[model samples]
Target: MRLGSLIETKVGLNTRELKKMSNVTYYLKKFADNDLLLGYRPNSSKVSCNDEFVTAGDIVINSTTNEATIVSPLNEGKILTQSSIKIIIRDTQQLDLWYLCYLFNGSQFIKKQIYSLVEGTVLRRITQSNIQDLDIPVISLEEQKRIGESYRIFMVRKRLRIHREEEEQKAIFNFLEKKITYVKKGNKDEY
Candidate 1:
């Protein structure tokens, strides 16, 4: 079924919640690589994993509070979720969380609205009021399930490609190391 006719509400039961941080709940600004980031991966503690944020999964976007392009997931930030920065939407069983996430990523319908509502001199943002007014397209539970499954497949393919690239790089490095070793031995025959 079409979303406009499904139940009645902007957000379905599936909601977005920031995993870290406290305060500044409800509506928040999400940051990513100018794209939709999905999946749940642990942040790297070696350097700065918190700053490596994405606009995917259970996330609450907070455009206000602080203006930091890179927020540490391990530290306190405006976009981080705590007890206050959370919004719960009651879905009509016809919808699911994965579908909602995909819809959010689409951004075709809401991007313009968000840009129009966000107010700032240098940094643009979408306020909570904007989120409330936004409308989400609803579909049948089966459709939602299909969409969710497709998303999972896409993620797996992307990860596999990344892994392959890393392996190729490692092979190249190993080959170079062997060549260097051969050269040091004055074996000029090493190609």
Candidate 2:
């Protein structure tokens, strides 16, 4: 089924609108490294409605990455910039949001389409219609739930592993620094 038939999408504020200042909502912009929104900003206009805000379970896509990411809990009230588009699922019963995100971030079929669209563009940006019109594989609700749950677990584990690796590298560098200091100041200079 085409994703457009299953979900409604909201484009974020344009660059001139979303700015860093008095906080209305944190801004989700491009170059966001992880699954979380990174910065804060406010819209010059009045607080119109809830539709402008994004909550957890919403998916955000970037033209640069051409990938979809699930909004983290930390960014429940965040707004978005033009660099990102928020995808809202119309029916939770019919589809699993997390599973859909997994497919967008990793599925070859979706990636192929996205890559094709962004292939020769200078900004590599894709229109909302492109994402809306993507063809997605259909599966039973039960299957989707299972896949979504596993995908969530995989993300958690991947985060932990990366954190562990970073800590290990820091420790190694710290120890090396200590050894270098000792060699420089101690009995013999080790070159």
Candidate 3:
């Protein structure tokens, strides 16, 4: 989908009862380039520019709906606290911070929206305000915590599985090499 047309939902919770709380914050890429982020970490005070920094740790959001790794060093320490950052602080009690971080890092949900706003001549960047405007799924704080923990567990398991597979592959390669060497020596005896 084209980046502009992908954003069809609102930026916060859809509570039908009484009220839905929402918060917003801003971040900018200054010191880092574009390849150094895994995603935005709240309260991270690392910076590379000449300004008062508001580390990713301070910027809270429901989710990060942008292209690229949301937490790249390229973009890290670059986000400032000035007009360039545009911190959107929403008063959200339904959703907690961890859940919002998980949602923002999701791949399928953020692809088109991030692409639409990430525009620049040389850097291809998105403003902090634009990110706040991106739609996010809001839920109860308990649910948010559950989802966030699930995401963390899932990542840990995946890494462990990958490591095991790599070790198995290495063992297979070693066995094959030993067998090949033995066969070569046997054939040489006939000479």
Candidate 4:
């Protein structure tokens, strides 16, 4: 099935418009590391040429992530700017959200199709039409649900592992800091 038939695409707000808003409103900016991790930053005072915006259940493909990632916007006004395309599934029943995300992020065939649309030498970009025009396999509702559920579980485990690693790193750093401080204090008399 044609991807366009299964999903709707929207262009997000540009950086220029986002910068005009109150800095308190967090916005997703492209080419930033935080943005790749589904993180948002305060709108910058500088103007931007890129335009993008995202709401709940929006799948964004951009240079930052270099792949598709689902986004759950915290507020209605949160905007995505720069090299991002927001994709919304037309019908959850027809195409499972998690399944679609998995396809974009994991399926080699689908990834090849998506990357085939890339254009430009220095800064490759995928056009919205290219995304819409791609073909998607039509799976049974039951199968889609099963795949979607599995994908969700995988994502949960992945996040948990990352959190655990970060905690371990912090603990190791704190331990080393305390030991260094104790040794420094002990040698103070020698100095």
Candidate 5:
């Protein structure tokens, strides 16, 4: 089945408009080296400038993540730039949202489908139309829900692992900083 039949897709905000916002918050992109971050300005008109605003349950995909993650309310109600694609499922009965996300992000078949449609000279870009036209395998809703649940669990574990590694690195850096300072001050009594 064509993905367009199952969901509504929209392009995000542009970089120029995002920069003008006062208190811009999280922004998703297709090719980001890091997670999207922006400042927000409550009083600024730029906040309401964009026609498309991402809401909770929207599946966002970018080049950096290379996968779709469902938006939590924490990241909700923010305007996205053109660098990412926002997808909203039309009917829960016909298609499972979680299943769609996992398939698009993890399935090699889906990746091939997307790559085949990608167009760019310097940076590869998959347009909204391209994504909408891609083929999606229709599966039983129960099976999709099960697969989606598994994918959600995997993501939780991945995040925990990354957090642990970051903490360990921070500890190592702190220890080295203290040790260097002690040596520089000639305060090492035992050594």
Candidate 6:
């Protein structure tokens, strides 16, 4: 089956519309880059009204990487950026959303297809038609759920590992800074 048959992809706000609004006060989290948006910053600014917002289970495809990941609750209420596209599974019963995400994100065959479909020279964009034409393998609902669950679990662990690595980097930097301060002051109280 074609992937497009099971999914609907929505392009995000144009660059101009997005530019007019301030990031300080956004109703949506502004889904763009996973690396920067994984953990949104806290602010006291009032949220502006918005009708279009992304929810958990929605898929976000990274324009650069051509990879997709299911949105976690942490990223809900995000307005899609121009560079990003939000994918919604048409019917949940037949095709597992997470399983499709795994295939789009991890499967070498699909990745190659996506790579070939890329059109733009600078941006390397994927059109809706291209997305629709990709092939999908049909499997039983139960088996699909199993694979989807495994993929979801794998993604969670990968995120946690990334978070741990970032924390470790911060800790090491702080330790070195403290050591430098202690050495410079000739104070061993904390050291």
Please give the CA lDDT of all the candidate structures.
0.44, 0.69, 0.43, 0.63, 0.67, 0.67
Every candidate's CA RMSD:
10.3, 5.9, 13.2, 7.3, 6.6, 6.5
lDDT of 4 by residue, 117-160 (tens): 77777777777787888788888978986886687677766666
Q: What local lDDT score does residue 188 receive in model 5, on the 0 to 100 scale?
A: 68
Q: Write the per-residue lDDT of candidate 5 for residues 52-74, one digit (tens) a residue.
A: 66665566777433467665556
Highest TM-score against the true fold, candidate: 2
lDDT of 2 by residue, 1-191 (tens): 98899887778877566665356765545323456322122222122235556665567777567767766556667777777777777777777866886787768888897777664446778778888888888999899878877776777777778889999999999999988888878748553
Off by over 4 Å in 2: 19-21, 24-26, 29-32, 36-49, 189-191
Q: Which of the predicted structures, 2 or 5, would earn the higher lDDT when compared with the native?
A: 2
Superpose all Cα atoms of candidate 1 onto the true structure and report the RMSD in Å to 1 decimal: 10.3
Per-candidate TM-score against the hidden true structure: 0.53, 0.82, 0.48, 0.76, 0.76, 0.75
Indicate the TM-score of model 4.
Answer: 0.76
How good is model 6 by TM-score? Answer: 0.75
How much is 137 displaced in model 6, in angstroms?
A: 2.0
Q: In lDDT terms, which candidate is top?
A: 2
- lDDT, candidate 4, equals 0.63
RMSD of 3: 13.2
- Greater lDDT among 3 and 6 belongs to 6
Please list all clashing residue pairs in model 2, or write none if there are none. none
Better model by lDDT: candidate 4 vs candidate 5: 5
- Candidate 6 structure quality by residue, lDDT tens digits, 37-144: 342222221222332565655666766567676555666676766556677666777777667777877788888899888898887877667788888788897898
Clash counts per candidate, in order, are 13, 0, 29, 6, 10, 0
Candidate 6: worst-modelled 10 consecutive residues by lDDT: 39-48
